[model samples]
Target chain A: MEKIKELDLPSDHISEFGDLVKQMHDVDVNMCYQCRKCTSGCPVAEYMDYSPTQIIHAVRLGLKDMVLSSNTYWLCLACGTCTTRCPQETGLLEVMDALATIAESKGIRSNAPEIAKFYETGLSNMRFFGKLYDLGIAGMYKLKTGKLTQDMGMGIKMMRKGKLELLPTFQNQGEMRRIFKKVQEVEKKARGATDK
Target chain B: MKYAYYNSCSLRSTGREYDKSLRAIFKKLDIELVEPKNWICCGSTLAHNVSRLLSLVLPLQNLAEIQKEGLDAVVVPCTACYSRFKTAQYEIAENPEMAAQVEEVIESRFEKKVKVIHPLEVLSSEPVISRLPELVEKDLSGLKVVSYYGCLLLRPPKIMEFDICEYPQTMDKILSAVGIPTLDWSHKTECCGGSLSITRPEIVRKLSRDLLEDAKAVGAEAISVPCTFCHLNLDVRQEEIEREHNVSYRLPILYFTELMALAMGVSEKDLLLKMHFVDTDSVLQKVVAR
Candidate 1:
């Protein structure tokens, strides 16, 4: 998906963010009661600029700018730990995902650019190959991030063990391209509705 | 028992050993595994992060194909792929709007009832578990390992519906039945820095180190896992984690299927134990003839 310009701030940014999350993910942020259960169970809570509970609270209070600006969602592992623990069944993973897609839609640069690049590289690989080319994705990620020598040793060892594929595999590439196009169309229509 | 096998991408590459051992064990169990024609990737974490619709559509499309082929169930060995399939079904069942949107994207109706069985669930099933003890041709009770469920198999309890999320017993149950003893330990459902193993190796090192330390403290000789990313982070990255942290954890990460294959008298060479980054010889040597 191509990056687009950020939309102008709406009168009620809180409702805008909450409504979009509710509409898109079918999750209501209003259900979170500030119990901090999500924050407590999160594996990467220590690394997040704003913890999962705080992000949920921010969403409730309509602190979209603050929530989107933080590195919290980008660092989220999406392991579903908090989602499982929440008594409210708030679907924390979907909330984090909404924040991520929203950040990308607004063209707000992620604080964790490498993580963002990793997702972008992976999605592009899937769109083109119909299957994930692990070797290709790793090679491209290393080249793009300039971490060429970071895991060079491990890469060689894996290659020798026949664990890493030397070539890309394909399956129904034509249908995959069409599916990707349809997804883009759906997302674009959703974006237009939210912007209005 | 017949079912379609969904190897996903990892089994074809980094986790090929898992594929080898699983096929080996299933052959011994007398279960038929059929690979559906032209099965595509499940889109894994990458799809959901980009567009929620794509994630559901990808796996839903695969399910549609399996259903069309007259198969009602599929065996998904990779936990990551299994989670995606489960999540897709959960989303569709929970939200009709999503179901319609997914139907529109894939140009097909998803058979939400199609069974997505992980190897852990398959092995622990009544038919298989009951026959495990007699199937053993080699003794493996000497090898002690902790069962690491990682995140996908048991998390988001509502969606997965496999085992208890926090204190899962499925892996341990399967291991014990085959005369393989598993140590009780924490970090069963903990996240292993998953896909971040690539983008954020630092975090993976820290998280994986904690898990390895916990297993060592519990006296586990090795770690067994069901997910590809978990195996890659815990097994392949063991050396890097050791060097970066100034410690050595020679714990070999093993697939539970490999252990079963060993018990069933599948040769060590056939199990692909040598392909692991950590030396699995120490654990392999512990197996005695029954």
Candidate 2:
């Protein structure tokens, strides 16, 4: 996904953001009463730039800049802790995901760029190779994060055990690239409908 | 009865130990697991974080293959993969349009019928473990184990549709079937900093330290887990966690299936206990004597 160009502000930004999420898969943000049940149960809330509850609150108010730029977007483990406890079953993981796409396409940098780098590297690896490569993803990620040599020892150990394949293992890369292309086309068609 | 195995990327590679032990234990119990001809990654956190459609379509395509093979269920051992599978089913089932969109991307019909079962759900099934008593050759009678469910097994309760989101007991029961006395610990369903073990090790170090410390306090000689990421963080990185935190924790993390494989007299060669970074020799000495 490329950076979405800055557009003229919509009359109701919160509704626009909420509508975008709801349109994606009918996410019912209306049921979220800001009870903070999601926040209290989140494992990484303490480390997050915005609490899960706060992120939702930001969403309710349409504070996309704050929500998108926060570290909480990147730190979520998608462990389903909050989603399990949610009385309305809002699926906060999906919310974080929706916010992340908006953040990424709009060229909003994550508060946790290294975390963002890991995801970017991982997704790129999957798109290019048809599957996640443990060694390859780590190499690209270290280069992106400039944290090379951080886990060199452990990498060597895994390599010795033949866990890290030097080359891509899955043979479905051609099909995978096709699928990736088709999805991008679909997303483009979806976005093309928007006035942005 | 037989089911298709979605032995994910990690399971096929880095988590090969888990793959061996899971297949070994299931074989011992007379259950068969068939693999779909060409399954792919679950897209994990990466796909979902990138594109919603990519996340749903990846798992849907895998399920489509399993369904075409006539398997109604696919046993997924990796917790991360399981989470994506369950989430895909949950979201797609709730929205027919989204499911159709995902089907378009993969160019296949996804009926969304595959049940994503984890190892605990399978091995802890009454019919399966009921046969364990007669099958135990080595009898891991006196070993103290703490079953670590980690985060994904039981969270997001509605979507997962099994076990208590917090304080799950399935892992405990699976360990019991293998003859180890499983402890009830407060940290059973806690986060092990999961995939962030790569993005941020210090976070994993702190979280894993707490889990190891709790297991130690409860007199657990080993920590048994079903997730590859959990095993990687808890076992392979324990030494670093211990050193960084100024503590000594000599805990050996075992894939739950490895423990079961041990009790069923599967050889150390099959379990590959030596592959673990933490010394598993001490823990296995007990199982060997049994």
Candidate 3:
């Protein structure tokens, strides 16, 4: 396994982000032995700058900036290959998620603009519509991320081919709104409990 | 028997044939499938992997809806949806506190409780398979198939305890009922790299190609699977894999329901062979050609 540089995290940093780090630790972050097995099994490691092992390491060190800004944080597909295969059985995926929560809480956006935009747009669309309206979400994502110009020809061709539907079929809009509202309340309570 | 049908995203969009065939086969089997009044994507592997809570919430909400209808179980045609629902159920059932939290969340939202079942489970049940012999209009004598269960159907067995995780023969047994022979290939429970097809095509291509080649090596004329995602990966990605690996591999992938429908004498057009990225006509035509 490649040796990872140990960062000398500031004393105040640990105190400031203690709760978030504690939540991450609750996922058994300390069990990692730098084996890199998680990285080896990760499907998205090739696409990420930081391997799964490195991301976990970053979380343990309380490097919020590194944890949030790294492409590994956003690029992770959460396949559970690492978590399932981890020698120590540490929930490496959950740790990454806790890191993501902290990142999102701090309003730290993904360095990969497209993925961040997709995440925001996809979640907001789901929250509002109670289900994914793929075409609507795609259009919104394209418009927000400014990639609409690059894929204009392809989008048009897909529309012409009848691959892209202009209208979405929603199942139950009122019920979905109720569900989203409940989830929001639950998450808010969970966050508040953690803060206390 | 009546079931709450949880049609995952693929069935609604890309794999509509699965939805159609499933409904048709159930009707033929004298089974009533009720689509949940309000359904959402089961979050599949993506949501589960990204956020365990989000993944659990989606399926738990669906299950709650099924419970509201007073149904004990749901028949999920999509393998990913089955896996997600089963996983959530297992987790919730194991942890009472978490289950309470989930129930509170779901009850507050939908005011219901729900159980889930995969179509394979329903199809393999004694009640359904006992009628198989009577329903076979065309025996699949010429069709040689390899039943690909994929990881979702069998893996994390606590969640998917419906069949033998290592070597499930439910699909094979159902296929044999209609006269199709199955190869005893060990790749039945192998991973197909599913949506990884989109995030990482190369890995999916390699994994899918290996499964197909193994099936072909064992003299399988076609590969049959219960998961639409597996069908998409195995069938659609074969072209790319063949080009990438420079191999002349052409394997027609069919949903287990489609095979069942074929044996039950459904027409080719109704099964939607034209919609498939890989042409099933060649392999299927041989079986029904006479």
Candidate 4:
């Protein structure tokens, strides 16, 4: 069994952010006995460079770079199989989510460019419209990531089948703007806290 | 009771039959489905996986509109939408602080009091189930249907609470009510690799093929489910599954509502079997023949 390492951080970075991580540790991260049950059950591990167990280990060690840049961070589908199967009742998925939040804050880009592009477009679409328009978001993602030509045939077929509507069906633009403003406010607060 | 019906993305596109059948069934049961004005996608699996906060907020905004209409509950026909809505509801109901944060994020006073019900729960209620036999003009005496209750409908059952997490009997009970003999099968609550159907086709193919083969092992001629995403995965992906596995298995997958509509004397054409990639004609013929 691999010995668990305690998180060591520089004095400057030790504040509410560290406290936030501790609050997330309410899920009994210490209960993980290196069973590797999470790794075995993870569907994405086959394609991921690091398994779920490894991601947990990295987070436990506070190896920010290793945890953030790993494929497992972006690849987890949060199926809850790991959490369900954990003998020690470790909320593995929740821990991964908190880690992912940390990684996002750090602006650690994913090796999978498509995944990041998808998130950006999705967030932008939600911010602008207060809802997701799949066709529009997909188009925007493709344009931004230069993957437009990859699945042009599928897009053509979808359009032909009336699956891809050209225009978004927005009921109230005012409501959307209000929601976007609120999100911006929340993000601003979090950013301020991080800066302090 | 009236509900703001969210047909969701899949039902609007690939699984439109589910929408048609659900509306018809709800109409007969005296349940009024008030379609929301200019509704958008529920963010489904994509939004939830990418950003949890954003996903919760998007669905909460939609629910806010439903609340504004004075409806207590929103009837979601698509399983993914039902699961996501139910999940958001649970999260909001449990974590008041997170709810407040989400409420702050959306700039709306969300009371965290709305209930999300899947169409199956509404359709398979005691009153609805009791009225099934009387409503069935055509007896599905011979259709060997396997009720596939995909992962969303069951798991994380703490949120869904509609049926048994492992072996749900709602669909089977409804099928039996309409005189359709359901196959006693395992793998009912198995994962279909869902949205991963797009992101990871090979994995989905292997998982879906194994599920199809398991259903066939139990002598199921067709499979029925309450989820549009599962329907798309099991039915449309049959071609890809067959290609990848190097085997031919053309088992038609029907939305549970489609079968209910059929038993209630709805015409096959009206049920939109034509929209399905897998032809259900052979299975329907067996039922007619019996």
Candidate 5:
């Protein structure tokens, strides 16, 4: 109850966000019913600024700005817990994914910058190397965040333990490059219709 | 049983012990796992989190490659890769438009027909567990473990659909067959902070502290997990967690396959159990007591 107040939902009506989510995935955003089961079952709900149910409600009411700017979806573990436990099978996790996609393209400032940085570094390295390069991604993230010595002790030990490989880890980079390009080409066409 | 093994990128690199132990155990059990030609990453969480289309195409590329080799069932050891493959399976089945787009993007057809089976599903089946006497060289009678099946493997029951989402017991069944007693614990399927282990260590420390504390509360000498991420989070990060939480927890987080390999009399030196950051000396002392 108190948390919902923090949303400061817009006074005027703009329920299009609800309609928009319904357009994105198979889940019906309107049928949320405010059961609160999704929020209760969420693994990272405590860390979230707004609960999953609250986000769903905000989306249902078309509080796009409020929902997009919030950190709830950013913190979601994608553990599939809330979706599994929902009586109506609301699929909040699926909705969260769709919401995150929309949030990024709209230039919304991420409430969780480290997560965005991690994704940026990871995707860049993954595309370049044709697979995940553990050391490369970690090194990039540290530089971006300027947390150079963050987890340094464990990082040093893992390097010795062979947990961190200090090289480009794959071949066939040309094909991976193609796949990355092809995804962007297709994503623009697919989402450009539903979004814009 | 034969399978086109898709070890994913994690198992190929950071999770070598998992791959090594799985191969060693299956070799003794007479199960064959063949790798299809030209396999690639499943795009991991970055795909689904970034573009739903990449998540669909990347896994489908691997699935199509396996199908081309005529293998109908794929053995996915890494749960993150397995979940992406399963999510792709879900998307391709319901959305024809997305399906056509993915097929066109990859320049190949995804028949949408391959079965994505996890190793736990295969190993825990009655047929495999029932035949353990012949394969067992050292029964794990003295070992006590808590089976941890973190998120991706079994949740959102409609998708993962393999084990119980909240309270999974497949690992318990599989481990018990080798004579190790798996105790009941509430955090069996709890989230271990997922990829946030990299993006947000604070979240992982709290979540894993609960997991380690729960496992200890249940009298587990060691913890067993199937996912590489879970093992890394629990095993690699335990000391940090212990120091932060101001507690003493020296739990050996073992991959389920490594335990299976151990029971088959594979030596500790060969399995590299000692390489674990949170010393497995306790588990080693227990399991090696012929």
Candidate 6:
């Protein structure tokens, strides 16, 4: 376990962020007691702007800006290590998801734009192909991030090995579109209810 | 003995070897695996990270297909896809509100509870386990590897509910039954920075290097994995890691299914060993067919 940097506190705290997290994930953000168990178990804790424990603390304190803008949630691999090890069973992984979802919805960009772009590019691949297109996602991601040559060698090697598919392989694009549309409608309804 | 097979997007592409080896071994063991029609992607971490409803519904779309196929269980070889199916099952069963929402979105009645299982679970259990020793046409006693479960298969224990989350031994037990031995090592269930491999290669490099270093420290010849991303991160990125760290750890990351296939007498061509970036010759050379 590495030492976590001090959490920079903000004076004005908003309660809606805490409520949003609790309502979205059904997790009690207040259950975290600074145990640091989540932090110790986290593989990317050292790379985080605010460690898992501090993120939960910020959520509980309603430090919406700090928690949402921090790179902690974006860097999370969704490995479920913290969720499994938490004594309080605070559902830290879900909390991280909720935070990222909220951040994306609010159009608040985090420090890690590549991570966000990865998710966006992957979702677009799913939308068009009804599944992940390996070559497409890699090419699109590189174009979006403008790091076109990052894995150029590796991509060619994989293609040579027949590991990279040249064409989209999955079916049922209509079903995927309907699923996305219905999900949007249902989420909008849920948000409307919550906003009330 | 029969199960529906859900080969994820990765399996059709980067993880073709895992798909080939798993199907080959299951057929040899006399266990039936069927592929349901109109199966779509499970939306993965992207769906879950953005919309909870989308995550649950995406997997349910596939489960609904399984239900229509009249199969009681589906064997998902990819641990990430397995986790999504399991999470959908847990969430739907536990919460009526979410279930109703999912049903509404999918526009179908998902009354039957289809069991979502991983290949590791099936292979580790009887009658597969019982028939394993008799089916061994190759001697794998010379090969020693560490069973890497990665993170998704076992963690967040309540949803997965398959094996010991922290120190899982299912893969180890299956290997032992096939005449191969697995060395006890830490970081069995540690994450390999899954999707971050695309966005944050440095993290994948560091974490995967840590896993390789640990496997080397424990005196294991290779590492056996049940997850596609772990295979991609560790095996495909081995050269990059070696170059970046300026160290040599040419560990061949094999799918546990590939090991089972090899031990069960499946040929190298059938298993598609050429797809791997890391040369698996060292591991394959040790297996002598009876």
Q: Give interface RMSD for all predictions.
A: 1.1, 1.4, 3.8, 3.4, 1.3, 0.7
Q: Pick the candidate with the highest lDDT.
A: 6
Instruction: For residues B20-127, write the lDDT of model 3, one tens digit per residue.
Output: 888878989889988877777666654543344666787888887677777877888887788788777777765664566566667744334365678877877887
Superposed by TM-score, candidate 1 places the C-alpha of residue A101 at a distance from the truth, in angstroms, of: 1.0
Candidate 4 Cα misplacement greater than 4 A, ranges: A1-28, A104-107, A123-132, A137-168, A171-174, A190-196, B38-40, B110-112
- Identify the superior model by TM-score, candidate 3 or candidate 6: 6
Clashes by residue pair, model 5:
none
DockQ sort, best first:
6, 1, 5, 2, 4, 3
In model 3, pairs of residues that clash are B63-B114, B67-B113
Poorest stretch of ten by lDDT in candidate 5 chain B: B281-290
Higher-ranked by TM-score: 2 or 4:
2
Q: What is the TM-score of each candidate against the true structure?
A: 0.95, 0.93, 0.81, 0.86, 0.95, 0.96
Candidate 2: C-alpha RMSD after superposition: 4.1
Give per-residue CA lDDT, model 4, range B186-289, as digits (tens): 78877777755544556677777878999989988889988766776788778767876788778989888888888877777777777677788876786552
- Candidate 1 lDDT at A87 equals 90
- lDDT of each prediction vs. the true structure? 0.87, 0.81, 0.71, 0.71, 0.84, 0.88
Best by TM-score: 6
DockQ of each: 0.68, 0.61, 0.23, 0.30, 0.66, 0.83
lDDT of 2 by residue, B168-283 (tens): 78878767766778987888888899978998788888888889999999999899888888888988798888878788879889998898888888988877676788898767
Lowest summed lDDT across 10 adjacent residues in model 4 chain B is found at B46-55
Report the lDDT of model 2 for residue A77.
Answer: 80
Off by over 4 Å in 6: A1-14
lDDT of 6 by residue, A1-196 (tens): 3333455545444357788787887888877778998999999999998899888877877777778879999999999989999998889988988988898888777599888888888998998889889899999999999999998999999999999888766678888988888899988887797778
The lDDT of model 2 is 0.81
A best-first ranking of the candidates according to their lDDT comes to 6, 1, 5, 2, 4, 3
- What digit string (tens of lDDT, one per residue) describes model 3 on residues A34-119? 89987886656777778888877666665556667787766665445676667787776567666665566566775666655666
The candidate, 5 or 6, that scores higher on DockQ is 6
Write one digit per residue (lDDT tens) for candidate 5, span B1-290: 89999977787667888998999988887899998767877889887777778879989988888999998999999999989888898888889988988887789886548999999988987788898766777767788899999999997678888777877889898888877889999998888987898888999999999999999998998999999899889998999998897899899999999988888788877886755898887776776544
Report chain B TM per candidate: 0.98, 0.96, 0.94, 0.95, 0.97, 0.98
Better of 1 and 4 by lDDT: 1
